[model samples]
Target: MIKYYYPDGSHCYRALHTAHAVFRNEAGALIARAEKPDGSALYEFEITGFELVVAGERCT
Candidate 1:
């Protein structure tokens, strides 16, 4: 899963590597706004059909 942090120090999570849909809500509109729970927005991106994967161990 993907762990997203907010500007206010809060965070959320999402499943990665799956053909699932992701979203973000801002000012009454849903867009690619993965903002930190602290109200901080993340890197600007227009993505779809991909899950978020957090940093973890790597296997070979």
Candidate 2:
């Protein structure tokens, strides 16, 4: 699993097999838009603030 962190210390997580992801928070939201490495939008989400633990495969 891959971990993603915010400068503030929050985190988000995802499975290596996850094809898409969406994260949200109180202040706002973030879209971990997916693609085929060629840059595409598989899916997206609105998240807020920051994340704590993000796990997933790194896009090529």
Candidate 3:
């Protein structure tokens, strides 16, 4: 599972790891994805006018 959060919105997805494995260690400032609630195969990938909100991954 993976949850990509944007400034204005957020996404909770159940990724097919065998096909598209999104590793947290390799995701840099992004959240360390684990199992989450209300997940689906449906996903959206866009950061045009949004900012990624990660916890403790940045020095704010």
Choose the strongest candidate by lDDT: 2
Per-residue error for 14 in candidate 2, Å, reads: 1.3
Report the candidate with higher TM-score, 2 versus 3.
2
**lDDT value for model 2:** 0.45
Q: Compute each candidate's TM-score over C-alphas.
A: 0.31, 0.28, 0.24
Sorting all predicted structures by TM-score, with the top scorer first, yields 1, 2, 3
Q: Cα-based RMSD of the predictions, in order?
A: 11.0, 9.4, 8.9
Question: 56, model 1: CA deviation in Å?
Answer: 2.7
User: 1-60 in candidate 1: lDDT tens per residue?
Assistant: 765444455555554432133465464332344444444445443432232454453211
**Which is the better candidate, 1 or 2, if ranked by TM-score?**
1
Mark the regions of model 1 whose C-alpha exceeds 4 Å error after superposition: 17-54, 57-60
Compared with the true structure, what per-residue lDDT tens digits does model 2 show for residues 1-60? 434444455756544444356454465545454444444546554433323235323331
By TM-score, is 1 or 3 better? Answer: 1
